[model samples]
Target: MGSVTTSHELFEVRRIAIIGAGPSGLAAAKYLIAEDSYEQLDVYEQQPEVGGVWFYSPEIVGVTPVPHTTPRGPPELPIWPKGSPAPLFSNPMYQHLNTNIPKPLMQYSDQNFDSQSRLFPSRQDVQTYLIKYSQDVRHLIKFFTQVADVHLVSKDGKDHWELTSRSIITEEQKTVEYDAVIVANGHYSVPFIPAVQGIEAFNAAYPSTIIHSKAYRSPDAFKNNKVIVIGSAASGLDIGTQISKVCRKPLLNSVKTSSELKLEQENKEEVPPIAEYLVDERAVRFEDGRIEKDIDAIVYCTGYLYSYPFLKSMEPPIVTNGRRVRDTYEQLFHINHPTLAFTALPQKSIPFPLSEAQAAAIAKVWANKLALPSKLKMIEFEEKRIEELGDGAGFHVLGFPNDARYINFMYDWVKTANDGFAKEPARWGSELVHLRERYQEVRKKFVEAGGQAKTLEELGFEFSLKY
Candidate 1:
């Protein structure tokens, strides 16, 4: 059954539904279409267009529906009190945001960007690329359609998903059943603002000023204001540097010390994580026993919570901790329902390539050209992963060795089908490993040089030129 053949009867897939039309969803559609297996394809996008988080919009969309009130509360209950409404569709991209990964590493295995594209493409470049990828399959997509609910129903003695989707404009709802469902709704929508004492009170005192990085756009809005950017991740660093150009003093608040990782701290003041917000004094206290006064705004780049609001049918829930998707076989298929559901979920890695690989493997699995481990084996795999990776943010981050290992594993799994599907460039896995080594060398040099700020181009060329 895990071997390629022309026998359609061997595979049970019929119609398939993809939740989002973003990069992962688009990749899923592309690979599924390549399989030429499914009879019907339905791609649903809640936004008016594709491109998921890459498509930037200044207009604030719906608020983040309180997850605690939902039937399956947040995977890890947030610090927010009951009934806290967050700005739902806040644009995660800023005007000047560029891809964190180099362009060569960002493309799908079968596709390439424009010849003249930059090493780090901008948000517009990414969105345009996605829109073009969807062009061939746009007819199959239902834009402005949201998957309101996904329920498991028994149809003809087989597992079928009853998808309740609604039009955002007309508020009209429709129900459809599919043989399988791919959830590419993305993990970046719900902002995860860490619980900080007095944060709610501070926001109450200065409405609309304190916001998550999702709500961030132009640095012009932050001009002349003293802003403290939290979370030292990619988004936080980019937003902080951009705001530093206009703000009187832009301070970066992070838990990472110079001893941990060499950071470019020459241009901006870096401080310890905020211990608490002094709402009355319009100040903040750092964990290192320091107090900063007269802060005008606080922008949280604390990343996003893993949200699968539509998935309410699972007994134990897909995401048990709100950080890692639990009980999965290779973190791709749900152990209990491998064929019924899948997720192109990857983190802290080159997203497009990883998604493409995951999608190809899933398509083969659905087509019965690729085999999954037995239920007992899958349970053992999940347990081993949790024990090794630990049940924390580390589980979600497929950094370094883990990312390369997963990608290579999928590429190998896909090849087992012998179905002539797309595969990553020969030796791409080696390149990833080499790239990690080079990146560490670059970081080592920067740290040894006393923490001088360097351009991304300078660091990127170290590996790109060699590769």
Candidate 2:
């Protein structure tokens, strides 16, 4: 017997499974396909459409505005893969919701948001743009499918792994072992509804009115109703604002009152894997039968969890601090599971660009699997922050450095871009491109806020035109 059954074989991966089909997943598919690395590709999405987290994601569905506000009909469908449908972003959306950030600032920098478009295009416009992006790269995905689990195995007694996926359609499960797996499922899959103390009794009492933020789409259902919104993130705040206009005297920011007055509420149940509880370190409590000023609906805009039900089989535990997927710096590789990687984890603004950049960089070093930043450093950072903050709750947005927020993203984009998989633009071409114009337009606003402005001449710009 020649060395028994040897691990001499090199793994041949024919297909790669990219989860979640949102901006991150779509971008990954675009790069992998455009790179021509794998012969076959599959994209698993829980949503019917291609816009992950945008096409009415479970998190932001509460703020998706009212339905069909467009004067003109929806945009024409883009050219997709034969039998594969066009993106859902092209569908009509509610009118009240406008992009919080301006469109020009939000574009991929390489892609234009149409010159005739509004500064802050409606949610519908963003969706349409996403749909167009998917159609342009439609050859790359298999939609309406989902990944139930992914495991790293020593198949054939080798260093390679097999990937197992389950389709939501036909209730069929399939396995396609890949040399690599990209978990692009994103974060919004599991809605983190804070189950308060009386929540059980309340639902037992008012089952019809108690709704998670995920199910909410427009105010039409909430009109004239007394609403009580929970949490204070952008999602929660936005819902409260919307309901205030439509509902009668919405109790805005009532949940935040505990923290505002430094009143600590005791023994509230915490949501696991995410250290923070539904109630803040400071919480709101009332006597029996007094449910916060006679509110009819309690909209739980409590946010999302870092849910990877697929990773339940993996041992050694992936420890997460609050909303963050911790122990992994920059939220990429794992300290334990080296063969697997996840995308769509946002450390800060415009998470897609940064995530795409990081993934592409890792792909170059794909063979160097299990390469993690030192565990000691990771442990040190986490402990230090846990000590400083006293409680690990919500996003640590400014958690990194001054330059890291943008630089990390720009760096990741270079990998596939350099290989011509994605367009490699010389300049970052972010807001910096419009810096001078922006400065000229808003210098007054900054000065009004007791700030000083440096002119182009002073800031080292030689201008041709007279001021």
| Strongest candidate by lDDT | 1
- The 0-to-1 C-alpha lDDT of every candidate, in the order given, reads 0.70, 0.49
**Best candidate according to TM-score:** 1
Residue 271 miss distance in model 1 (angstroms): 1.0
- How much does each candidate deviate from the true structure in C-alpha RMSD? 6.4, 10.7
Candidate 1, residue 358: CA error in Å? 0.5
Colliding residue pairs in candidate 1:
none
Q: What lDDT is obtained when candidate 2 is compared to the true structure? A: 0.49
| lDDT of candidate 1 over 1-467, digit per residue (tens) | 12221223344788899988888888888888888878999999877788988877665544433111122343221122236331124457777776656555677766666655554567887888888878888888998787888887665555678899887667799999887889888887667776678777877786765777877878898788888887766777677777877887545555555323334455478788888888788888998889888888778777776768788666667775577777677778877666544555667777787787788887888888877766778889888878988976677677777777777778777887866654332225455567654554544454445433233344434443321
Sliding window of 10 residues with minimal summed lDDT for model 2: 260-269
